[model samples]
Target: MTDTAHALAASHTLWELVGRRAELTPDRPVLLQGDRRLTFGELRGRAERVAAGLYGMGVRPGTVVAWQLPTRIETALLSFALARLGAVQSPVIPFYRHREVGFALRASRAEFFAVPGVWRGFDHTEMARALGAKGVFEAYDDLPDGDPSVLPAPPADGTAVRWVYWTSGTTSDPKGVLHTDRSLIAGGSCLAHALRLSADDVGSMAFPYAHIAGPDYTVMLLLYGFPAVLFEHFALPAALDEYRRHGVTVAGGSTAFYSMFLAEQRRRPGAKVIPTLRLLAGGGAPKPPELYHRVVREMGVQLTHGYGMTEVPMITMGSPDDTAENLATTEGRPPEGMRIRIVDGEVRLRGEAVCQGYLDPAQTAQAFDEEGFLRTGDLGRLTDSGHLVLTGRLKDVIIRKGENISAREIEDLLHRHPAVGDAAVIGLPDAERGERVCAVVEQPPGAPALTLPAVTEYLRGEGLSVHKLPEQLEVVDALPRNETLRKVLKYRLRERFSA
Candidate 1:
């Protein structure tokens, strides 16, 4: 890892961050999959060649390049390669059907797509052909037919767009969220500070690399001189093993991930994990206090809660020393290079961590104030200690005649019921009481049948305000989840109940 002036100039890019990583631990492993592993030096060389190969195909910087490959070393390296060439990486989940993939391709406006003819057992060739995309870089990871070259030259400075992230389209077509080198680098720097990460840490994410959390978190890990392990998915059983195998000290993910693993822990009692494990952090949806309790008390790790979006990946959260209560109650204060304002009880943020906004200027303008604070659609209040406590989504609260109720408070209370495994509170259009409170629930495995009366009784015993209590309760098999497994399309419940 040479200290070229070019590296310093482009220090915010993914490849540049890894260059710093190489200097810190040249002989240490940077990536691991099953039995295979790559040291920093080896990874640097291979990724360089991959970048050069894409360059040879005229894949220039700022190019929106998509991935039709699986979660292999190639997919990871190609993502790095594109960033090195000043190109944007757009990763599509293999689970996405043809129609969904088409939407992503169109929304991202990807000019180049790297696809493996086949991945695992899936035949990607037909899908690639169906894509009808030109400049397709096709290669099979199981075997290499030819050699790739060294890294391509960096893109010119002050490039307008560094990355393109599609908004999770819970309701409609996903809009692309553009990022700059400034935004990406700022994200890395803030994450490093927020988690108090170190070179001794090994960061492994089980989510998709195309995500804001995935790639941005990887950049932070690599910049802090830590190796990052990627799983095809969140393999909880293998995760602890990999943590120990990679000497991993930090773990992070969503609330659902923790809940799933907790269920597994319940299934298999007496399961212990990596001795060096220090931190377990994540936040996508509202996390229950009990979840954090298990992560700290049972899993034997520090639990953290982060608040971010596809635009600004890591914005605010409880740090390592933050109490479990604060982490569960609040989204934490705004991080460095960011600002937070509460107007009419709505959260508004501004600064480098904020997204430049959506691709549409009209939407962007609508998302921000004339003064430039990104008007976040979340409702929250600042505690006397300056911690931010999220009440619920601005649109999720129900106004019953004169009183306002937070759905999150009701949902959290419903979760306390031993019979209710999962819950969502929605405001249904009601001719009476203005908008009535409705609760949708999922029963836990091996739990007794849950009736509406039983749920109402539990809510009442929990001492919820009468107005906050859900007037109607509907039991469902499972809630819908988006790519990251966060329940994004909650409106479905209201639609069903109305029908």
Candidate 2:
């Protein structure tokens, strides 16, 4: 580990890190949004005031406060304020409606709920009230403020659980993943050290601040003493001006983000999309190797993808100095303290960055193995060089004619096709075959229509096994994706094609 990584890992709490960074570079910008900039000094000072306000409102250390707000400067401020008070904060994604939000509030037993109030045309305040959320208050634009002198002493212990983040809830109710200050710091340290970023590089937060990546990215900025532009709503071409205006050098949310940038670049073949963007990096969803190549070759930027989830914000990340082949084919390597074990072809993790456990004791018990390694349901193997190559999720395996096939393997190949813009391979129920491999794809704009025979022939040319060839092909205008990180929801694909 580098000296910086070691020091960041040793941070006692988020507030302590913020204070140390503020002292080091009081005037350095930490967060930015069109015409508004928050320096490290102001971040600490304002958060202290907000902490005092919440303290006066009966908030105490370990108080569970739930907030459902969009990605904005105010949201970041409120979150840091909660950290200053050592309050256990549960951040629900702003897009989550009654069912998910209600579930999170009840499961966390939150004493207070913060909403953005009619953000993006949704009345989150009304929804919170309808759910009978306690201590409901609007936290958009205006936030709580009071005298910091009245606040209690900041938290000294970093190991106490202070965060509750939810899983994507693909098939069932979202599980509240527990986290501590130290764990979040460790996760951020790994990301900061792996990306090889410097204080000079201006970054951008294109994803939801409510996601676990919120803290993961913030820790990077605090450690590196840099600033990141916060995007309340990110869409290509429309967001290009902001990226250029802020001179964002590092930008990316996930694979979907990479595709968006690539599409914009293709729209204007020779023009540089964002002249200052030198690197594209993210880690929420899978990165098809072909997409990596497209971004590098077409967009003319170094693309570094990582592997992470709600359970762990950052597991492995491709460094700038890594080889092009490794960067494209693998999920880079884990940082100093992260331990990755491949048990029965499943990826298991054990380290400071790993979450404490799920809120439900039963779910927690089933999550870890005997050695305390968190059993990640995703399947992957470590390369000879220590990089991770994820094959597919255990549930993503398709059984056709009693033979197992990996959907990721097929999807990766499909992404290489000239006409294929994005692809999702699903296994739909079939009476004769039990389950059949189906390839759903989105073609590039102005490209010729794709046919099933062309897709199979291309897969065959790529050395795919006959049995693994997709039995069905469905082309769509776009794949169904979740709002956060724009991860393609495979469950929705199955639902659309099952019948």
| Number of the top-ranking candidate, with TM-score as the measure | 2
lDDT of 2 by residue, 196-250 (tens): 8888999999988999999999999999889999999987788889999999999
RMSD of each candidate relative to the true structure: 3.5, 1.0
- The window of 10 residues in a row where model 1 has the poorest summed lDDT is 1-10
TM-score versus the correct structure, for each prediction? 0.90, 0.99
Q: Please identify model 2 stretches exceeding 4 Å from their true place.
A: 1-5
Candidate number with greatest lDDT? 2
lDDT of each: 0.71, 0.93
Clashing pairs in 1: 49-149, 61-86, 62-86
RMSD (Cα, Å) of candidate 2?
1.0
- Candidate 1 lDDT by residue in tens digits, 1-499: 1233224324755566667667767888777777888777766667677777777777776677877555566677777666667787676665565666678777677787666776666767677677776556675473222134444466545335767677766557776777876677666556666677666778777776657776667666566556777776566675667667777676667778777656655665666555676777777778766567766777667777877777777778777767667876777766656887899999888877677788778888788887888887888888987788888888988899878999988888877777777888888888878888888888898889877777777878889877677788888888766656454368778788864
Model 2: lDDT equals 0.93
Candidate 1 regions off by >4 Å? 1-10, 116-123, 139-152, 156-159, 236-244, 271-276
